[model samples]
Target: MRPRILIVDDEPQIHRFLAPALTAAGYDPLRADDGASGLKGIAVWSPDAVVLDLGLPDMDGKAVLEQARAFYDGPIIILSARDREIEKIDSLDRGANDYVEKPFGVGELLARLRVALRQRQRFPGGETVIRAGGVEIDLERRLVRRDGEIVKVSPREYDLLSRLAQGHGKVLTHKELLVSVWGPAHVHDTQYLRVFIGQLRQKLETDPAHPKLILTEAGVGYRFYSP
Candidate 1:
């Protein structure tokens, strides 16, 4: 079956331009013009992913994210006019899987969606073992080890760490990790990521505060430092 996507934006033109492109890209697109409407659509459509806008008429994007988390498990990519570093950080902190500023190329958006969804599929199913920085993630086994010693992790925590390790040192945006590990519904729950990252660092890093393995990218994302 073709993947379904929800596009939640207040602007009609945003939908007009991207919906057709999404169709061409081999996905179904559902449109919502405002936050309240978007939530309603999400409840009814149950899309595989969502392209969300931060600035909505009746509600801010953060609240919508909160609501979505309460009910849904899917990927959410923020498409918004807000481009400031602080805004991006806040959005990531709030639980978006990825963020794209307005006037973005449709192709780029599609590629990001591909990455998010692919990673999501890797979570519920099995994945190959990943080794980096003395940590071995046996994804298929759902086990993590440091220097051959088994490392304890909850199911969600294992999924989160495995995704980062699987990224192979590439930076993973907050939303990408959130959605991939927690699903589209949990994409906006950034605190969950932060808290669990801290827990993982405590177990994996020689020094949590001065981490040499799980590196932060300030306004962008996190990377599993390899080599």
Candidate 2:
């Protein structure tokens, strides 16, 4: 079956430009110009992945993401104009998997979407355990342990940490983390990411204020610092 892709943005030009690209890349396109309508479309269409813009009318794109996560478990690619470092981190923290800045290349967006789809397909049979930095994540069992000690983490927080650790010190931009974790609808909610990262620090870091594991990339996104 051809993958279904939803594009949620307020700009008509976005649909015009991306719809054709998505179609050419073997995806059925569903377009929404606002967050509320986008959420409804997501529930009804249940696309395989989403391309969401952070700046939307009615609600911030992040709220749409929070609502979507209540049911959907697909990839979300954030398409936003926000260029600040913190803004990108915020989106990733909220559970987005990947993000793209505005005026982005269609090729890059499509390529990342393909990557997200591929990753999701690989996890279909409930074999979910990730190990890195002395941390072990049994996603199917909802358990994380370091050096034989179990660590408690919220669902979203664990997802974030897992993705970062999986990257293994590779720099993931805010958009990339957001789309991968949160489902594309929240590629711009930096505040949400900030709060959760803080919580994660408290639980995992020896000093939450001076973290060493979940390392920041200055102006990009967060990464796992393997020692």
Candidate 3:
């Protein structure tokens, strides 16, 4: 069966443009103009994937994303005008699989959708083993290796690395990382996250000063750019 793609956007033109593109790509396109309708459609149609917009007339798109995540396990790609790094991080950390800013090319949007779907199929219930460049992380076994050599890391370091790796190219905010690794009380501890990120880069990057894998998004957070 053709994959069903639900597009939740407030703009009518988006539907007009995406419906044909999804059809041409051999997928069934479904539309919802607001968060309420989007949530309803998700419940009724049970689409294979979702293309969501952050701005909805009835509610914020992030709320829709959170609601969808409550019961839906399928991939969700956010299409929004919010280009701020923090917004992108918030959406990803909240459960969005991908984010595409507005004024985006149709080709890029389609490509991102394809990638999210492919990743979903490739790693179903989350990736247990992530291989990027020469680094291999077996989450289940709690093992880390680089260049065919086992790499030793503290329990906290491993926790930090796992959180970054799980983001899958999504930027993670400092608060999000701190909360995930050091618990809720550490959410405001930016220094702690920075120190650990520095350590992670030193271990994972070929050059810690000019990192290629673990990247700092300047005032935002970090993204694990997997190969």
Candidate 4:
């Protein structure tokens, strides 16, 4: 069954942008314009996950979050323009599962929702064999395959590929990748990371010159496209 996701934001623009994206991602999206109706929706419908905004016409978003947490245990990802550390800390402390600053990418939000749902439900499989982008990554077996045929990759290359795949759809920083695969000492080794990334694309992508699976985030890092 498709998970019913409740979007509690007063902004018409946000609703217009997210509703279709949520549908495309296989979620039945519903909405509420104000805090009163949002709380009512939560009590009546009991959605699987919530995309909540910090601003509301009736009450502060923290109030809604606090009240909702008292009864609803589902994931609540706070979406707001407020980026202050204290505000984020407060929302999280009030039982928000995650906080996304406004003007965010839909893909990032979807990926975060996927992670939150998995953590809450403990969805089985794929942990052992992570599959995405027309390939299978058997983590337990430490193997990569496409079209049922094994693809040979160096240990370092495989490690990098698996790291990116595990983080599917999220942009990972160069420092993060360097530290995860090559250890903390190699955090500054950006060139080394780039070399391994190119190698992985060569082996996995249909066209290494124009990779779709592993995408470069320019100055940031890379994001592995799941589908």
In candidate 3, what are the lDDT values of residues 1-227, reduced to their tens digit?
Answer: 99999999999999999899899998999999999999999999999899999999999999999999999988898999999988988887798777788988889988877766765566666568987899988999999999989898899999999888887766677777888899999888999988888888888888899988787877667877675
Superposed by TM-score, candidate 1 places the C-alpha of residue 18 at a distance from the truth, in angstroms, of 0.3
lDDT tens digits by residue: candidate 4, 125-161: 2577776657898999899998789999999998898
Superposed model 2: Cα runs more than 4 Å off: 128-227
Best by TM-score: 3
Question: CA lDDT of each candidate?
Answer: 0.83, 0.80, 0.86, 0.84
Q: What TM-score should be assigned to candidate 2?
A: 0.63
Which 10 consecutive residues of model 1 have the lowest summed lDDT? Answer: 118-127
Worst 10 residues of 4 by lDDT: 118-127
For residues 59-106, write the lDDT of model 1, one tens digit per residue.
Answer: 999889879978886778888888887777677656667778887998
Tell me the spans in candidate 4 whose CA falls farther than 4 Å from its real position.
6-126
Q: Model 1 segments beyond 4 Å from truth?
A: 125-136, 139-218, 223-227
Candidate 4 lDDT score at position 108: 95
Q: Quote the positional error of residue 163 for candidate 4 in Å.
A: 1.4
Each candidate structure's count of clashing pairs: 14, 22, 0, 0
- Model 3 worst lDDT run, 10 consecutive residues: 118-127
